[model samples]
Target: MRSGKQADFAYQAVYRYMIDLINEVSPDVRVKLPSLRHLAERLNVSISTVQYAYSLLEKEGRVYSVAKSGYYALPVSAPASYCTDADLLERLYAGTRRPGMQVLSADEPAQLLSLDASLLQLERELLRRHPLQLQPYSQPCGIWELRTALAARYTQSATRCWQADDVYVGADLRGVLEILIEVLGLKGAAVLVESPCDWLILRLLRDAGVRVIESPCDESGKLDLMQLEHLLRTESVHLALFSSTASLPPQERPHAARLLEQQGCWLLENDIHGELVFDPSTHFLRDLVNPGRLLVFSTFEKFIGPEAPYGYLLSRHLSAPLQRQFLLRAFRLSPIRQRAIARLYQNGRLDQHLRALRTLLKEQAILMDGYLQRYLGARLSYSMPQAGATFWLCSTQTVDMRRVFEHLLARQVVIAPGELFSVSGLYPQHLRLSHVFNGNHSLDRVMEALAEALKYGRIG
Candidate 1:
């Protein structure tokens, strides 16, 4: 307890020191904070304490964080476009002033806003830059331009030796998984997955007759690493499907990354949310983990919604037979869409949008988290999703989330109950609330409904 107090004092001291240093810098100046470990050693405080202080500064808009990079000083008015806690809260509360405003809000947190308009904008840009050459037909491995663009993406941050054919661009998440199973002959193979996984991934493997083992999470919302270690040591597990960092608390990701690297299981990295992270310094296990045993894939749908729905699969170990199997089994995306995306990738317009989107995601997550605390208080439990637009929340077993779900559903708000996320109906007391708004409503209004749901336990 005394040491805890000491850590707190140290945290406050570090925070003050940071503010002082930041205040000294001019608006036009740019500076990088010492790395977390470096700052920890310098200040003689724990690394966790330094990390906490940095998070506080980021939330306050004094500093900017970059994933797989480092934190930097923010310019004055850096967060001008970001809605503040007060303004966002006011908007949410204003929505509650209306009659019958508690409709359920189903959280498709990963989807982008304005699908058709955005795609049309991309098409216009493509026409402006390149001659219109939309092919009538394309290859099974997808159009070369897009595949090559995706291959170039894989090499940008981490040096994973990837070539054009190494990427297969087509299909949704399930479709790609089916092709992987067929290509790798994973039928009846023992594959390890973390429990409380995305229902789609879990159900896909189980339904396919693959021997699926669910390694449970500990209270910290991280893999019960001991169990994972045991499974790796004892079980005949050929692959470990770590769905995404969104499934676990953010702070524990480094540990998970380390485990995946050392555990020796063939790694399947689903990096759908990799680009949507708040922390610019953030690095997904897909990039951090050893790439030799790595197979990576994600859909453009994760970024842009189902309007285009272009997706790609990348792997260096794509053998000749496997390549042939992929070519036959997988279909290519539309040529025009592929060409437009390839142009965006090459021109850096798409990358700029993604970077802005990441900032928006982080800002919204923090604001809505504040609302959650104010509305539900300790009655609800959750961690801010490391990389997406929704908060993965839990409540006590006594609180029937289904009743809340029903209550919200009656009002036409379609929130995703946690049970829907798992095949076996785990997280009955859990639910997902999205921070992204499509102009129909806002999060503050959603918080009001959730608070009301808690107040009347028998609403169903």
Candidate 2:
């Protein structure tokens, strides 16, 4: 007796009920469903509602109907096997032997800037000025002074408008990303990541149960907008996580941002190496994307060396909710470290350190590139270092990357294989080398080992 509109709702409800009943029954076993009239009478709905519900189940393959007989349940599909590539990479990295190893694998900066007497003195003075900060736990969003300083710095440097409340501090970029993922409710959602991205982040997304769609990039590390647009048009991607400055140059970012925004996708820009820009007029995503749809992340660990533990996230859309969730989860960063970093920024010491670090890294990159080209010749190809300390190298089809990696590992020279960066295991003939971690003299040894590996297929 229900009306047409009410019958639609009744059918949907009955559809769910029938699905539950079908699931409870044994697979491949025929369960005779009640007739349309009988179901309508039992559920106190019209016969059309019952028929609509049964038709839905039939369409979904959850049940099938014979010409004259009743409907029967279908067997549910089994779950797919889990991929262990990330776990394998994790174990391989942990088992890496570091004793007397000329490590060219880490993305850490080459030289740590020596703190001058004035900077050391200032740190002591700040600690004395605020002894209470060292006594108890700090705020979950981190020390306000540091956040304010960071906001001011971003506004001044990038010409992006920001407030202190827009910043959230965390232990590191990974921890902050985890929190961001949770706050944005991205678990099990489709996320588009640039192919050959940071390996750790790829693993994180996989572990979070999200459907990861890898968008391929060009030789220069820039994302292919055409392919990205194709995916956006085809897939239900919720977020696009990518590096802010690496791979793609400044000019291309705005166009890419426009494409993403048009498709209503959120952008998570990881600007970890934004401070080491070789170009003076480089533009960041903050200047391109709508702040309401963007989340920018950066860390001192890349610029100030890996010893620096502090990192910050800036997002006008998610900051308030992120802070609430951060506090609710009882996450706290070290107050002392926060104050120390703030002091560096407050006194312009961080800028001074950055100038020196950039010069050193640029010099080292040139040296490493020269050595690589000189030693390996036509066997390997790599692009010049632009922003970050790492170089992405592609080997010729004749060379086997696995053999080269094993050869280097045997010589106590650990190098990151290109396969680790790809989810589909596409880059079997590529490698990633970090110039900042190894000195010029040690790099000479790396070249020697690589040349030997190329010639003899082993390093002994």
Best by lDDT: 2
Predicted candidate 2 versus true structure: per-residue lDDT over 102-143, tens digit per residue: 656667662434344444455567567876555435488878
lDDT of 1 by residue, 1-460 (tens): 1142133235568888888877676654557878978987888875645665665565334675544578777343222223233232222222232244442332344443424355657666655565435433647677888889888887855475678978886544555776777776777998887765665566567667788777766434577656777887788888887765644556666666676667666788777777676676665666556778888877776666544455567878856765676566534344556676787788887778778777777887787778888988777876666676776777753676666765664453556666655655567677667777555666667778777776565323
134: Cα error in model 2, Å: 5.9
- Cα displacement (angstroms), candidate 2, residue 46, comes to 63
Model 2 whole-model lDDT (C-alpha atoms): 0.68
Minimum summed lDDT over a 10-residue window in model 2 is located at 75-84
Give RMSD (Å) of candidate 1 vs. truth: 21.0
Q: Which runs in model 1 stand beyond 4 Å of their true positions? A: 1-118, 122-133, 156-159, 218-220, 244-264, 330-332, 442-445, 455-460
Candidate 2 residue pairs in backbone clash: none
